[model samples]
Target: MNIKKTSVLLTIILISINAFCQQEVSLSSKLKSDKIKAVNRSISLFGDKEDAVEMNAEDESGIGIIEDVEFEKGLIEIELLGENNPGKSFIGIAFNIQNDETYEAIYFRPFNFVAKEQIRKEHMVQYIYHPEFTWRKLRKEKTGEFENEIKMPPNPDDWFKAIIHVEETTVKVFVNDLSEPVLIVDRLTKPLSKKIGIWTGFGSSGRFRNLILKE
Candidate 1:
């Protein structure tokens, strides 16, 4: 074989090796105080369920950062449940956390999953980078670029699966078993931190389970 062809074969082998070596960690094994760090929120193992944690925000938004885990990329799959509380009910995953105030988050407005109005339906899922590039700012500036409607949305008042694929510059979110992502947006920040978390928005409460992080 020529030198160029040999180099291409070596590159493919290395890529496959790296992908196989990535670890899959289950973060929902326990919801004890030593396992999770709640930021501006309160969390406890859901009384009615096993292997799940419920989160309630104290102010605007709250995060439950998984202790000792640092995830930068790959795939994240979790089950989230929120209510159909109209203006409330924002729940999803957060990663690349720089601090309590600065981080990247992708959350859902469960109430808007099946809204009667077309505009409300379009606002079902959102992507935002905090301290700047907020939902309000993105909506006003980038318009439909950062958020989109979910096709075949799950029940707003019950448990639904979220699969998030994160790359260096892009993020894709899939709801339930959808073949295509419901929301895909170019990442707004250069991911520098390794923090991964579960998030809830203003006056919101959320339940999360089966948290799996593959990296």
Candidate 2:
């Protein structure tokens, strides 16, 4: 091929590669008020392993939605710390959030992380689609399908990593550096919105850091 044609071909190849490769987006940069939309939660920015955000709520659920992120199918990973407050510590990531009332989430029950009872152990991690399928509903009807027992649970009082891989039809959650996913479930709701968030359950306070999205 001629030099001009070869140059154009090379440029096209580069653009195609960039489009399909994973692009890491740092969510810590959107700490400003104009960028985050909080629902029934109070958020504060601080420094830990890196720049982090802490969320607290006394009643109802709390979620701090990153306003500009429009994630459909991608990977969301973050370091989260929750106390062993038995039934109070629900810390995890929320995505495809249409609003405060509706969304899909995969949260951890840190209180159940190292439970002695078999039932509690099974409830360590959960996936829920609000306004329809909640933890209570899924547990009652579907039984042990939506939630899973973490074979290697993390410490409740310390920082642990939660990596969630969201896909068109399914979601997989890996705790810490585990090669195998602790929880895997089919996607319940369709693509509602592009919003993604950090969530904490009632009476729970969570510290989050190293929030990243690969798309």
Candidate 3:
């Protein structure tokens, strides 16, 4: 091709790449939000690891993925890269409770009996909001309060599948091959405080290759 034609081709390629990079992220996509949806400010999570981060394994290994979105009902399918390590011992996603800048809700695993079976506290969605591109935890709470807030949703130590069912008044979580979830949270009747994030407990980690949210 002539020099002018080659230059034109390169320019077209550059524009195509730029347009592709600027595409908006969907609630179910692997890409995290570039900025906060509400405040419209940039939020930086730990070392490029936002609450909703996308990770990939070269050929199926110990890696897992996290995501952030707002879905009422959907099938979030997680694929395991490490097939040899069957029975997985444990692996799955996590969702932290937040109120604007603080997380008042505790992090107890919904099925873990270690935590007291008590009423899930209420959250205000009006002023409160979940992190879209970032996550923040409360720091002023007492020792005991901190323990309660950080409780992993059911089986924090062990891996389990979770289905988030948001109702008119509560959010129910179904875990590990069980038809019923051990924990049923009375969701805040107000609007959604913030976007939901995906979590994979420490030690027991894996990547989410696909997340299909369908009502």
Candidate 4:
């Protein structure tokens, strides 16, 4: 092949490889892909769901502790903590928000860099206290489908920061500030929609300190 042609082919090959090996994101920064949407841009403060809370519980328990949280503009924050309360494993919190509809999924982004091995399982299911979202006996997922897991930080109890970026089909998570999200569950390629408050998973009863959904 001519030198110019050869150079062009090499460039194409490099780009293709980079695109595959390259990650969707490296941190809690902007999303370059068309699928990613920056929904949690703003945060609005509102009333509280004034309710004493505890740890996760058995399924069929109707919102053991419901907090009346409120918000306004954009980003919504759901704060949950065991807070010095040891032996608090299996506790879960349901984030009910008011906004445009969006997909249902969860993930954790440890340092925002998701190792290849992490994408095999569903992180949202395991990390999220709510297993009913797709539990067969619980009968939650209507489609009877499954997707890849969105990895969480190394340790769930560890004091690491994470962000759940919700768009259409894809949910991107960032760990420790914006480091290529520990994992990107689904790369949404569909239209936009609104997502109400996050549902409290079944068999989980945890305390939610702060919950808000911006309008």
Local accuracy of candidate 1 as per-residue lDDT tens digits, 72-157: 99888889999988987999999999999899999999999879998999999999999798899999999999999987888899
- The best candidate by lDDT is 1
lDDT of 4 at 76: 32
Residue-level lDDT of model 4, residues 1-215, one tens digit each, is 89999999999998887565422221111111222221322212122433222333444322321122222123333443322222222222222222322233342222222334543233233222233243343224432233234443344443333345545455444444545754444432332323223233334333433333323
Off by over 4 Å in 3: 1-29, 32-159, 200-210
Cα lDDT, all candidates:
0.88, 0.86, 0.33, 0.34
The residue pairs found clashing in candidate 2 are none
TM-score of each: 0.87, 0.87, 0.35, 0.38
In order of lDDT, best first, we have: 1, 2, 4, 3
Pick by TM-score: 1 or 4, better one:
1
How close to the true structure is residue 148 of candidate 4, measured as C-alpha lDDT?
31
- Overall local distance difference test of candidate 3: 0.33
Model 2 Cα lDDT, one tens digit per residue, 32-133: 545778899878776655678788767887888988777888788889999898978999888999888899999999999879999899999999998699
Clashes of 4: 40
